[model samples]
Structure formats: C-alpha cells, structure tokens
Target: MLNRKFGYVFLLALLASSAAVGAEYKGPLDVPAKVNTKFAQSNRLTAVAKAGNALVAVGPRGHILVSENSGQSWEQVPVPVSSDLVAVRFVNATHGWAVGHDGVVLHTADAGKSWVKQLDGKQAAAVAEKSFKKAVAEGSEQAKKSQDLVTRFVEEGADKPFLDVLFLNEKEGFVVGAFNNAFRTQDGGKTWEPLFWQIDNPQSYHLYALATHAGELYAAGERGLLLHWDRQRQYFSAITSPYQGSFFGLLDTGKELIAYGLRGNVYATADGAKTWRKIDTPAPDSVVGGALLGAHYALVTVGGRILLNKSDGSGFDVIPASSPMQYASVAAASDHSLVAAGARGVRVETIRDQAIQEK
Candidate 1:
C-alpha cells in the first residue's frame, strides 16, 4: 500500500537499507522475479483496488493477489520481477498497471490474472541519464542537476521505487516515484516519456499519490508537495498546500478535495486549492488509508484506527480495529464496505452497521 502515506515511510526504509550496499549491482534486468509457493496471499500488502467486481492487491516480493469474491479468498498471480510492488490502478474491469520498487512497472490486460513487465529501474535510469545529459549539453541549469540525480540512480541500480500510478485509459498513463521520478505513456506501455523535467518539482521530492479530483489529475507528496495537471502544457503544476508536512493520500469526495498525510493531518478544499481548512483527527498517528464512505470520508490510520469525517467537515470520530494490524491502504468496495490491505494482509470491513464512536 504505497499510497502517499505508506510510500514515504516504506521508501525511506528501503533507501536506508539499500544505502548499505557498497556499489550498485547491474544484474540481469530480464530475469524473472522469484515466486513463493506459500503465504503469497497472507504476505504484507501495501495497496488494494477494485476492478469491476474483483479486488486486486499488491505488495512486497512482486506479489499480486486477486479475489473475485471480495476479500474473503485471494489467489496469487505470477509476476516477472522480484521488486516490491507498492501501488496499483485499474482504469476499467480489465485494464490496469502496477508499479513498485526498482522502478518496476507492470501491465495487465486481463485485470490481475496475468501481467507483463513494461519497464524497470534498469531501463528507467538509462532513459533518464540520456535525457538529462541531453539537457545538460543544452546549458539547462536544471538538467545539470538532473544529470547528477539520474547518475546516482544508475549507480544505485534498481533500488529506486515508484510510489504511485494512474491511467487515464487503456493507453494514456503516468507513474510517479521518489526523487521526482515520473514517466508518461501515451501508447499503452509500449513507450514512456520521462516527465521529471515537466513538473514543478525543482527539489525532486518524491511524488507519492496520483489521483483525479473534479475530473482533473492531481499529485501529492513529500513536504507538502502538491501538483495538478496542466492540460494545456501537458505537465503538472505546483498547487499551494496548507500544510508543510508530507501528504500520503488524496481523496476527492465529489463535493470536496481532501489531502491527508503524516501525523493525522487532513485538509479539505471545496474550491480546489484556493481555500483549505483542517479536519482535525483525534490522534497524531499517520493516516495510511482512506475511502469515501457514502457521504462521509473514512481514513484509516497506521495505528489501526479508522477516522471518519462528515462531508461538511463538521463531525469526526475514531474507531479502533479489533486487531493491532498496521493498515496501509483502503478502498471502497461497496457503498457499505471497505477492503483494506496492510501489515496483516487484506481484510473486508463492514462499515454500515458500525456505530460512529467519536474519540
């Protein structure tokens, strides 16, 4: 569940571990990722999505799980890489893409039943290096720094991770990740253009979430990094954020735009980014998962508590899970149910009959 919330913490941990390596390992990029026979469905999953009537979840070890009967039973789907998958998006019932560590991007034509690797860190770094070098040669100051960044990417091998992905349809899509790594594909997964230079991310902050609000695309990430699609320029422009902390998830409840992140910080804007007001939570724990439950917004914290807010932003409540499982991502499976994935695997929660217990 590498939504905006979990991607930052997970990527930081991954970077910390990879930093211990003395040098980059440029091994075979085409090698198939390993598949564990057992515990595939029970493994820690980062994100979940609804594909028609089916539920798809992805996580560490390139694991992808699908459950046609909601979250009750899941079957593992074979993947081509060993990278940790963080985020997944399904445009319709069948077409979708999954992104993960090592800058890995995978595509599925038949929903989550089968997949093919579209791109990975090996090719991503190469593409970036070439593009940045070209920019440097043209005397672009930004390119000079971009070259250094991509050079480090090459040195780090496939350690980088793509935190989030979004597809406009079966063909047009985008994948975003740490250090301003973003790519766009107009011809399905056949080709991708490096978008690192297009956005207003001068600091190269990690782009954690890619979403659509009011029929417009938006991205949010580290240090209050917020961006909205500029259709005319074919780029994402920076949006003014009310909070300076990292935002982990973006939710559009039709009536309002919500950006939530570290330390239970939730801000809402009904007039796009022109105005924002804080929707205070009960605790300081990070909000790792969220969904639009009917007329309210339900946000799940990493501390295993679910926070609920009214559409008018007038009421708030907290409901603790029965177990202490650290939830990562959640999706509205139905009008009354939510499917969440995280440290304890995937679970279906019934919210209709649950009483609102304010904290």
Candidate 2:
C-alpha cells in the first residue's frame, strides 16, 4: 500500500519501487504470478472486500487471503500474477476481479479460491499506444502527450498500476489507476477498452478512487481530478473540484457523496458534483479509507485516527483508537465492529456512540 503523509502517486511509486514501475516489465500477462507459501498472508495487504460471507484481502507479492469467519483465520489462495494487487471488488459471491501493478486484472469464478488473468499492462499499453498513434497526427498538447506515452510504452511495455476497481455487476465495471488509466469491461472481463481519451483529463493526472451512488458513478484522483459517468452520453465527464489538492478515495453513503484525500481534506455533495461543501475534519492527516456502519460513516486517516460522522449531515468527531498506528483500509466486520489493517497488521475495534472498545 502507498503510505503517504500527504496523498499523491509519485511518492508512492518511490516507496514501492520493488513492486511498482518496471522498465523491464515482461508484460504481466506473460509472467505468471508466483505464490510464496511461507509469506503469502504475512505480506503487506492493501485492500479487502466482502464476498458474501467471506472476507478477502489482497496485497504485495500477489498475496490474497480469504477468511470465512470474519478475519479470525485466513487461508492463502493461488493467484496467476505476482504483481502487487492493491484493490479488489466482487459483484457477487462467485464473481469478482482483482487489479494491481503492471495494470494486471484477475477474475475469479469461485469466490476467492482461484483466479485467472484477464488483462495486463502489456496488452493495455498496446491498445493505448494504438489509439495514441492516431492522435499523434493531430499535433496538439494532448497529441504530444499521447505521442510521448506511445514512446514510453514502446520502451517500457505498460508497467503502470491500476489502484482501484469497481464492478457494478458481472458484466459492467471499471478499473482506474495512475496516469489517467481507466478501462471498462462489459462482457465480464471477456474484453476491455481504454477510456482515458473519453474523460476530460487534459492534464492526465492519476485517478485514485471510484464510487457509485444511486446508479451514478464518480471518480476521484490527483489535483482535484473528478469524473462523472454520463449514462446517456456513454462517457465520463470531468467535474470541477472544490479543492485543488489530490483526492485519495471517495464514498457514496446512499445519501451523500464524500471525496477525501490530502491533509484530511474532505467534501460532501448531496446533489452530485454540481456543488460541494467541505466537511470540517478533526485532524490534518490524509483520509486513507472509509466504511459505512449503519447510518454512520467512519473515515480512517494515515496516522490511524478514526473520525465518525452521520450520513444525515452531522459534524465529524474523532473516535479514539487503542494505538496510534497507520491503517491502509477499513471494513465493517460481521460482529458489527470495524476491522482495519495496515502497518501494524489487522486491528478490530468496537465503536460506540462516541467511544470505542479498544482491542
């Protein structure tokens, strides 16, 4: 996981040098990911998702661990690629996808038991370069950037990573990542097409998070980059951001929209991105992850602080943790508590009205 005191991509790339950006990437699809039985579950995990009743977490070295009983114990599963997996999503218990470094995407048919490579950076780079070559003839600022990307792909073969993924169902989904990377797979991973050119990202900044509310999809990223999918138009349009800093993650509480990132900056949009109101935060640390607990929402910061806010427009209050340690992601446990994992491994805590049962 990218550990940022203040959120951004390049700094994360530097910290994850061993697994990220490779000049000699052998095309992740060509190189099958290896499984190290000894270190599978022990490696750093980035994200976790609930597959029906089972909880699955993915991380560095292609580590995927599945726990059937609310993270009490875990079992490592075999994955095809060794590229670091950052985000995972499941439309149903039996259908899911995992995306990671090298733009690798994996699909599973049997919950989290096994996975197959669906797309990789090498193929994505080829497709992107093909599209860029056409733009190169137009001779504009975007064209120049496209041409440069083509040259980079020719030399590097698509080593960029997909940081987060969203699957609305078995057939429709989107995967987003660094450097304006986004793709759509409508046929259940049978095929994927690049959607970078369709969005209004003239600067081509990194896209960090994807969220959907009331059938509306929104993407958040660097330098206040925001995109909203126009179902009627069949494309994502860039929306003006309330803040100019990078946004690391986004959430839709079915009542309000929250875009969070650098320096504990967060905003809420009840009427979509048309207008936004900044949520008064309790700390200055970056918001790393979030979870919906009933009518309340929990936001976890980089320094392991938990902030609680109501979905019905209440001010945020800091929920103290047992220990002040870094946490990368947050999920609601089956026991009605919250499960957070990061630098100090997994920690489960009971959140009351304003107090917490530290564990």
Candidate 3:
C-alpha cells in the first residue's frame, strides 16, 4: 500500500520496485523479517515506547529493537513480517501492541522480547465486509454507503495499512489508519470489529493518531480532522479543528490535551477539546511524536529538533540534538532519559536539567 503520510514516500518506492522484480516475490506482509545482528542498531526506526523498565522500538522492514537498561543500548528482536511498522504502544510492562504498513498488528505479552501477529489487511478487510453486510441487512441509514465500502475493501486487498494502535488496557483498544479505516478489540486483540461506520468521517479521512485524556478518547487526522468518542452514543463525534493540516499525534500532559502536527501547528485544550488555543513552537517542521517527560512535555520534529514545554506551561523551548537527524517518535525512559527513534535509528539523550526552565 502506498501511504500518503509524509516521510513514507521512500518506503513506497522501495516496495514498488520489489514488486516489479518477479512474480514469485512475496510482499513484506507475508514475508518473515530478516534478522540483522550486526546492523540492527543502525536501521531506520519509526516509533518507540516504554515497556516498564525496558524500551521497545519498531520501524521499516519489520525491525523491532529492545533496550533493557533504558535506551543506552539496543538489541534486535525477531518479527513475523517485514512490513514497515509505524507506531507502538505499551499498556504495561508486559502488554503492548504495534501496528504499521500492510495492516499489520503485533502483540507482545513478554515485554518486547517476542511478538505475534494479531491481524493483517486481508483479515481486516474480511472483518469490515462482514460488519458492512450486517449493517445493510439491518437497514441502517448508511446501508448504501456501507455496501460500497465493502466492495472497495475487497478490491483493495491487503494494501491498507494501520497507522496507529492504542490500548486503554490489556483488553480494550483501537487501531486507525488510512482512508478512515478503524477497528476495536475488547479481548486484547483476540478479535477486532470494524469501527469505520461508528465515526463521523463520511469523507473517509485518514486517521493518524489516537489519544485519551481524562477518560476521553480522541482521534486526529488529515485536513485537521478531530474526533471525540461519545461513550453513551458509542460513536466518534467530530470536534472543531483549529488547523487545516494533518495532525500526526497527540499529547496528554495530565492537565491539558495537545494536538500537534504539520508545520509546527500545535493546539491545546483544557476543557476537553470544547475550546482550543494555539501553542507557539519554534520548529517549523512537522511534530511527529511527543511524550510527557516528568513535569515537562517533549515534542520531536521530523527535522530532528526536540522541544520541551516550559515549566510554567506558557510555551515550548527547543533543545538542540547532539547530531541532528530526522526523528519519528520519542519516549521517556523509567530513569527520566529521552529515547528517540527515526530515520537514523534510535538515539538516547538525557535532557539537561536546565533545558526545561522553571517558571
């Protein structure tokens, strides 16, 4: 599948060429990931998460790395498929999920040491088809549209990739991706139900991120699309978006919610997204990932800059990287160090105490 997300053009080009090589060639979704003991540390990594005391990061070609002593060092782990992994999240030290290209979803119960495939694009399409059929039979108002979607899903095959995965607990979570594709799992990904029709995305915008704050779940995506899950209604309701650019991720600072994305656009809302105020940031690049670092929030840019929230929460200050490079994701280690994964692989940096100035 060709991902329209920024920074994935190279990956799509590589896949296109591979497909032209031979008819017997297997797609990354079905091919097992190759182990590279010597060069695993240098492979491009897209996302990182803290698994208790351990750190897990994933990236293109199904490369997964685990760091035991914070992010000081990393070791590659075996994965089932070679599909590009875009995002990963851990509910606890032992339970975590990773999702990416080819609609791949992988789960690990033993921290990041091992993983098993929970779903793929082919299976996901089948799930959506089944759900759509039921909706049509029940005479749902959106029946006609649902039927069309099923036909598209069947024709698309396994090309749609899940961009992000979120789990509220070990048993409850959601995965959202290109063209408004979404699914929910209540049994720890044992089974997933199609959730497209439950959201207010009639235009089928690609959902790039999912976040929760104060028990409220929100989704953000292309064209400034923002959605809030109405628990009672059991559907995702649209919220007024402050920017017209794609939002790559969200940050929950415990006190407020931040939606950040393209061209350094960042907005915060303290009243459950009912209102939002823009937060000025120095970096002009897209903010790809963020994490709450102790009392401060850290945001990483696609241009390799790290920005930290001021202690007073008034604004953000840029912290220059030792060796600047494109960064895709960042996470806070148990020891309060910062670990970032991206085009140049994984890097660990300990934020200087003075970087986050006190009010």
Best model per TM-score: 3
Clash total of candidate 3: 0
- Each candidate structure's TM-score, on Cα atoms with residue i matched to residue i, is 0.86, 0.83, 0.92
- The ten-residue window of minimal lDDT in model 1 covers 22-31
lDDT of 1 by residue, 1-359 (tens): 54986889889988887876635553434455566534876768899988888889998878888888867788888887767889998999998899998889999989799999999988887887777777778887655656666677778877788999999888899999998889899999898778776788888898889888787899999999999889998778999889999999888888888888999998888876888889878958998777877766688888887777754477467754555478899887777678888897887887645553321
lDDT of 2: 0.79
Candidate 2 lDDT over residue span 66-161, tens digit each = 778777777888887778888887888878889999889999888798999899888887777666666656654554645554566547866789
RMSD (Cα, Å) of model 3: 8.2
- Stretches of model 1 off by over 4 angstroms after superposition: 1-38, 133-145, 354-359
Model 3 residue 254 lDDT? 91
**lDDT, candidate 1, residue 31?**
51
lDDT of each: 0.82, 0.79, 0.88
lDDT of 3 by residue, 1-359 (tens): 44556448777888888888876778897787888844767868899999988999998889999989888888889999999999999999899999999889999999989999999999998888887888878887664565666688768898888999999999999999998889999999999998877889888999999999998999999999999999898799999988999999998889999999999989999999989999899989999999989887899999999998877667788886776679999999843568998888998878776665452
Return whichever of 1 and 2 wins on lDDT: 1
What is the model-wide C-alpha lDDT for candidate 1?
Answer: 0.82
Clashing pairs in 1: 1-46, 1-47, 4-248, 5-248
Q: Order candidates by lDDT, high to low.
A: 3, 1, 2
